[model samples]
Target: PGPGAYGLPTTIGYEKHDNRKQRMPQYSFGIRTNVSGKDAGPGPGAYQVDKLTRYGKGGGLEYTMAPLTKFKDKGFGPGPGAHDVHLKPMFKGTEAPAYSMAARHNFNFKKCGPGPSAYMYDINNVKQAAPKYSMGIQTKVLGKNNSPGPAAYGAGDLNLRLNRAPEYS
Candidate 1:
């Protein structure tokens, strides 16, 4: 979930049952290295020139964004569309490494069915999602602020004008 939208094709998967747990390794310890040389295409690789490598154990986590009752009251089943939180923390990197995985229940209702469609059918006819938990390693790169320091400064820093971007409203 970084910047720059080149509009790449993405595919999702759904399930028909609830009790969901992501597919991240319950446990894993490994190493990964990405070398950005004089040129490695564009976008993320545009600022290359170093071999960022980091390794460690890490996992994943997914859960309802809201409480069970709140979600149920909103006509949402414990399906993949019930508004969930996804996080993949890696243990190493230059400014931030990355990880990815997913888990969802269908209440017998999962739909990679296009984009965010599961968000539609919330008949309150299904049960709530059971509690789920996960642990993982922390990546150094992801933790870095790219500011050459521990602090993270965004567009708001350096007195950047807010109206400069489309979200200024």
Candidate 2:
């Protein structure tokens, strides 16, 4: 004669079954709320029961798309220059020691003087006259594929113009 079974019969009985038959539970519970809302309070820190309208801080999502444009030159100096200068062996030395490390290698420049002056042999040695070399002028342009142009100063080529030449000749 329990509380609910007060008027129950003496031979009353109930069936019993194992509740932990499955590995995972059949049901679960979770809390949902808008934490980034206007009516959010500073007390219990925004729980699932709080009902509020959310809003972003600043700029919203943009709907327009930007297109790519060709690179434009805005200034006035040399546009793109040539890649690298190529150097070819112009003169070969006669004496081995003259071109060797031990002996003083000299690169003489005989200026075209009047009638080969008697005492005009200015021994322009390597240490005395450090010879400066020059390369053929060529222009190259970087193409769409980022490659140098075939022709000098042509389309897609880098231009290298000489304003002046060496004073010594």
The number of the candidate with the highest lDDT is 2
Q: Please, what are the lDDT tens digits per residue for candidate 1 over residues 1-169?
A: 5776565433323333223434332333665444755455566656534533354322444466876663345344465665535554454433444444865323423343565543667656456766766698756655444536544445455336544545454
- Please report, as a residue range, the 10-residue window in candidate 2 with the lowest summed lDDT: 8-17
TM-score, model 1 to reference: 0.10
Q: Candidate 2: which stretches are off by over 4 Å?
A: 1-114, 117-119, 125-128, 137-169
Clashing pairs in 2: 140-157, 140-158, 141-156, 141-157, 141-158
Work out the TM-score per prediction. 0.10, 0.10
Report, for every candidate in turn, its global Cα lDDT versus the true structure.
0.48, 0.51
lDDT, residue 37, model 1: 58
Q: How many backbone clashes does candidate 2 have?
A: 5
C-alpha-based local distance difference test score of model 2: 0.51
Q: How many residue pairs clash in each candidate?
A: 15, 5
lDDT against true structure, model 1: 0.48
Per-residue lDDT over 68-101 for candidate 2, one digit per residue giving the tens place of the 0 to 100 score: 5778676744556633234544456554433445
Off by over 4 Å in 1: 1-128, 135-169
